[model samples]
Target: MIEDWRQRRAAKRITSGDGRALKRLRWWQLPFRALFYLTLPNGDGRQTEYAVDIPRRIDSEGGKARAHLYLDGRHHAESKLPAAFPVEGGTIEMAISAFGLKRCHYVTTAGAQHRLIPDPRSAEGRRARVEREHPTLSRSISHLSALILLVGVGLNLLQLAEPMSRIPPIAESIGTFESPVRLPIWLNFALAVGAVLGSAERALRLRYGVLDRAGK
Candidate 1:
């Protein structure tokens, strides 16, 4: 229903590519660049490779970032953020959030979705490595990220409720309310920073939710 409509809107954002060769990932670009790959059957007893490239940093003047789709290491197509690049078996979808990439997956015609493999030199790749090499530590870190976001959300809602309840129309209707717990200015700033870091960490693992978006 609604999902189909959203998919159609994303499809309309695609545009033809200029057919440039995909460049190799560079050392300096590791921090601010993300690359992912997917392989699918070509229907000729062979397989084809597809890569998605995205720049992490967004230009203030440009407004939004763009995503590049590569086939066999050559540019095939591209679109702005929240893009959907049609491919042989399905569509490769890419989207970003304020902290980092929140979605990068290949949705097949049959409806199954698979996440693309991150480039070995990229931050996502490193996070995947940590998960593979150290399961216990990885789980601990994942849980911590969730805990931080939970605390941030709780405190933020509490703080916002007090001010929101004081609005003229609301105060007259439901009386004024005061926050149960108020932190110092510095503590509030620290919590805000933690919320950002927590969201960024979840992005590395491709985990995002409505609460995270609301916090941002």
Candidate 2:
């Protein structure tokens, strides 16, 4: 009976602690419809803090990417990849999560003239690694972010449809209003321009991450 109880307890522990590492999702913060989430052992067992911008591009069906890794206030890893590349050129990838530890996967395919390495250490080396291990995953993340942002902005613009539906009529009505109460089209346009410029500035500020992927 004692042995049976011991066996039962051992089985319980094994079931609960399967020993498979996993990334944990802590929280996500979104700015400009861009989300930055925290993880440790969840996405990739990298144990590193990462920032990503899911993207929306016209040429590709989908994409997602690890935007960058946090090193101080700056990003340690960043990439500028076109939305679509001939599959033959290769790929880039990243994984992030929150847990006891972290792991990341990277993979790539080499062309006839280019060499492919299963294990890499340099900047290009790292990029190659990403391509090999997580080609599709990388692109999906990047594409996703852009798609979401574009969709969000589109929705916002849609809301203005009702108000803007009668622009010419509204303009005529405004003319009859007292000079003190009248809002000129030029003034409204200027306000819009200012808001757009402000949002752009914020996007620029979000820029982070620099990878010496070439191992330089």
Candidate 3:
């Protein structure tokens, strides 16, 4: 019931795109741009290309950032973040997080979901290339990212618990609690930086989870 309501709200947020030619991705824009593509059948045995473009570093002064949809290389429609754009078979869902995109996929009428392919020159594209060319190494890196996020989140929770336990109401009821793990300020800052990079790496692969989201 709640999902349905959220879907309707997202649908309402969409606005028609002005007719403009989609720009090509440039080298300098690789870090701040995300472009994904989907090729779907056009009923006549031909394929139609749809692209979703988002400039992560750019934002509107008064509203949420928008995701632009291009059909066959021309602007079609656009919507705010966490967009759900209706297409041939289903909806193209797009979402973003602090580090990068957390979701960009197509959900079919049959309930199956498929991720859109990133542009070959983009950062995400380079990451995807690495995965294809070096499967074992890619798997290892992915595991390391998860481990980093886990440690970061665990430390954060412990740090929070110590302060919360010191509150008068909680301390009176359950006694004072001390955190077992504590690090110097500089080391903590370093770990926080590592956590952000780890989350960004996962974002390049379109991976998201509770720990990944929390680390961001």
TM-scores of the candidates are 0.93, 0.21, 0.95
Give the alpha carbon lDDT tens digit for every residue of 1-216 in model 1: 997897889788777778899898887887689999999999999999999999876646657798989889888887778888889888888888888889999998999999999988888988999999999999999999888888988898899999999999999999999999899999888888888889998998888898688779
- Per residue, candidate 2 scores C-alpha lDDT tens digits across 5-97 of 643443332211222222222223121123233333334545533333332222132242223323223333443221111121232232222
Please give the lDDT score for candidate 3.
0.89
Global lDDT of model 1: 0.88
Whole-model Cα lDDT of every candidate shown, in order: 0.88, 0.32, 0.89
Better of 1 and 3 by TM-score: 3
Model 3: clashing residue pairs?
Answer: none
> Which structure among the candidates has the greatest TM-score?
3
Tell me the deviation in Å of residue 95 in model 1.
1.3
Predicted candidate 3 versus true structure: per-residue lDDT over 66-152, tens digit per residue: 899999999999888989999999999999888899999999988899999999988999999999999999999999988887888
How badly does each model clash, as a count of residue pairs?
A: 0, 58, 0
